[model samples]
Target: MEKPKILVTGATGSTGAPSVEMLLQRGHPVRALVHKEDVRSTRLKNLGAEIIVGDMQNMDDVRAAWKGVKRGYFCYPLNPDLLDVTVIFAQAAKEAGAEFIVNMSQKQVAATAKSPATIRHFLSEEVFRWSGIPTTHLRPTFFSEWFLYIAHQIKAGKLQMPFPEDARHAPVAGEDLARTIASILAEPGPHINRAYQLFGPELLSYAEIGEVFSQTLNKDIIYEQNSVQSMADSMGLGGSDHFKDHLANVISDDLFGTPDMNDVIEKITGKGPMTLAEFIDKNRTAFTT
Candidate 1:
């Protein structure tokens, strides 16, 4: 039997790249949608994926990429035009007679959320649902990959953030999220019209994260607290722009979020979620080197 070709947008991204690799390893035909033909795209091509280079916002490009592909993984990058992009992808999938779509969204997304990005995601999910398409939504929380952003701070013996050190969040592993996505894309029957809130096995505060890193890396790491305004100014999130709006929303979520640590990953893939300690152990080099 010819495996159904799955179209993966944002193919070179943190989640998309791993999802493509998993699909290929499972003997599924993968069509990777990338923005440019570069080393990353080359890597996907070398790994036996069909590469389609184009912008997601362009309907013609999306329509072209949707050709002959039945199931798709749709993910748009953080931008001001997510609603427009979702509309284009949903309409294209509808016209192409695409069977199932798994949309990547953020956790705690609601129309009332203060962040434009979160609200945009909430609206985007609606776009897919209203299209009358067989769609599944993956709403993953803070990624373990975010550690890389703070790796430098950790290496400097401190973990700095815009929020309080005690603010808690359940950060999901990127691989776990990708695995869940690929599994559903392979067998969309049971997942149709469902939204899964994916989280890690445990929730931890920044101070707790610092302790984990210190214990794992054999170094004294401390949590250095900073005001949200100062952090926002450092990252240029203080301005009234789309990026600032997104960052502010993230800060709000990080400070106030108390997400339930669910077993959705294990329920779906029969494997337990990865812990922060394991993440640190696996990527110790990033912290040290």
Candidate 2:
């Protein structure tokens, strides 16, 4: 019997790219929706994905991508127009008669959230809920990929971040999250309407993580507790005002919270998610000077 065709948005990104690969390996047909025909999109096409270049905010583009997709993954970058694009995607998915959606959400997003960006995240999930489509919402904690982006700093023997020195969260790996997503899409019957908080195998603070980096990279990496504003100012991160505010609020929220490990990744994928040490060692080139 043939499998369902799945559409993955943000298909060139952290988890989306790997999820596309996993789905193809599982014998499920995949359609990758990307913003442009870049090298990343070309790679997915080489991996047997039917790549579609379109904007998530454009209804016509979404409808084109959703034309024959049964299951879909909705993942948008952290930007100001998250809710707006979510509405368009939901409407298009409904029109496409989509069987299920694997929604990409963040941890600690509640309707009563203080941050506008976090509130937008909550409202986006609500849009999918109101669509009445079978949806599996994945709320992952800090992604381990966050470290990779700052590899230049680590390579210089210094690591600076926005979160409190003692603050911590289970930094989930992109591949682990992708595996969970592909597993659910492969068999959507059990995951319908379910929401999961994804996490890595262990919880550790930035300082602890720095120690792991030191041991893995064989260098004494220093962890600096920098203000969120400074980090944002340095990273720029597309120059979005709302995203900077969101980053500040989320970091503040973490300052007052405790961290712990969860088995959601193991529950879904039959193995524990990757550890920080493993992630650092596996991607050592990024951290090596």
Candidate 3:
């Protein structure tokens, strides 16, 4: 039997990079679709992955990249216009006859639409399903690596959030997300037409996160509750008041409220997902000044 050729879109991003690595390690011929011919693609090329340079928004570019690819792992970078890009790519994938598409989706699809990320992911899943391709939607919860966005604040010894200090989230590790993607691609028959909600081993609050950081870095850390405006300003996220208001609404309602899906991870990958403490410990260097 011949190894399947899997084309991974967004191959330079966190999840895509690891997914590519996992596929190659499992002896699959992997092709990485990157936007620009840059150092990221160079790195993947060094890792023995065939690199195709193109942007998802360009249909001609996407079609060229999809040529002869049997499977796909798709992820959109953080963007408000993701829906438009996804629709284009989904159509291209269908026309190219890709057998399976594993999407990197958000947990927000389960609830209100604050950002277009969740809605776009849902739409892409629908596109794959309607196209008659076997699809696996990997809806992972809040990522523990999101703390990297605010790592400087932790290094400054302050943790500020829009929600309460005790805002709970089931933050999954990105590597676990990659592992699940690899599992689905490696053995597509089992996950055909199914969506797997992936989560970490436990639910943790911001307060608990702070505690973990403090213990890991051996420094005093404090979690402060900031108003939506203040939080947005602190994060330097410039937008209309409506965006801020929607963010506040989602945060208040706790969009991270989801049950543990570690069982699914174990069932699919035959391994337990990484824990929050392990994630913090592994990435503790980012929190140090």
Candidate 4:
């Protein structure tokens, strides 16, 4: 029997890359849609993936990429114009007779007003459902790997934050999320028409994360809370007043929520999610320089 053709958008991103790798390892025929023909595109092409060059915002490009594809992994970064692009992808996917769509979505989407990212993904979900394509929304919690973004502060011996040190979050590893996505894409029907809340095993506070960083780096680190106004001043609102306001509201409420999903990771991917300490230990070198 011939394997189904899978198309992965945002194929160079953290989660998308692993998803592509997993699908390939599982012996599936894959095509990667990238915005530009670059070094990354060349590399994926070498990995037995058909590389298609196209911007997600361009319907013509998206339509071309969807040709002969059966399943699609739609994972794009947060952008203000994402909704417009998503609509085009959905329309194109439907016209091309794609069977399933797996979206990389946020867990806190239910609490806040539609940020550009959430709005676009929410619309994509609706489109897929109405178009009769089996859709699975993977709402993974905060990524433990995102700590690398703040590694500079850890190396400087402090974990500065806008919220209290007790602020808690369930942070999952991107690789784990990718594993779950690949499993579902490999066998489409069971996960179709469902939204899975993916999360790590434990709830950890900012102070706890700091401790993990300290242990992994063999140094002392401490979490420091900053006022909302102070955090806004430091992190700039980025010209989106609505996004800024929504962010402030969510952070004030303590954006790090508890884990609600049970062991869906083990059930879906046949493996436990990676722990924070495991992630820290594996990527400790990133904090060194």
Could you tell me every candidate's TM-score relative to the true structure?
Answer: 0.93, 0.96, 0.91, 0.89
List per-prediction Cα lDDT, in the order shown: 0.86, 0.87, 0.79, 0.78
RMSD of each: 2.0, 1.5, 2.2, 2.6
- Worst 10 contiguous positions by lDDT, candidate 1: 251-260
Worst 10 residues of 3 by lDDT: 110-119
Best to worst by lDDT, what's the order?
Answer: 2, 1, 3, 4
Global CA lDDT computed for model 3: 0.79
- TM-score for candidate 3, residues paired by index: 0.91
User: Where does candidate 3 clash, by residue pair?
Assistant: none
| Candidate 2: tens digits of C-alpha lDDT, residues 104-131 | 9978777677677778889999999999
Candidate 1 lDDT, tens digit per residue, 20-131? Answer: 9999998999999999999999999999999999989899999999999989999887788899999999999999999999999988787677888888999999999899
lDDT score for residue 232 of model 2: 66
| Greater-TM-score candidate between 1 and 4 | 1
lDDT, candidate 4, 1-289, per-residue tens: 8889899999987787788889999999889998888887788888888888888988899999899998999887656666677688889999998888997777765533345455455666676677787789887766887676667667788777665687777788888988998999999888888998888877888888888878878889888886545444444545655445545555433346544446998899889998888988888777777
- Clash tally, candidates in order: 0, 0, 0, 0
Residues 161-255 of candidate 3 have per-residue lDDT tens digits of 77777777777888888898998999999888887777888777778877877777788987888777776666676555544664665653336
Clashes of 1: 0
10 residues in a row with least lDDT, candidate 2: 251-260
Report how far off residue 135 is in candidate 1 (Å): 0.8
Alpha carbon deviation, residue 47, candidate 1 (Å) = 1.2
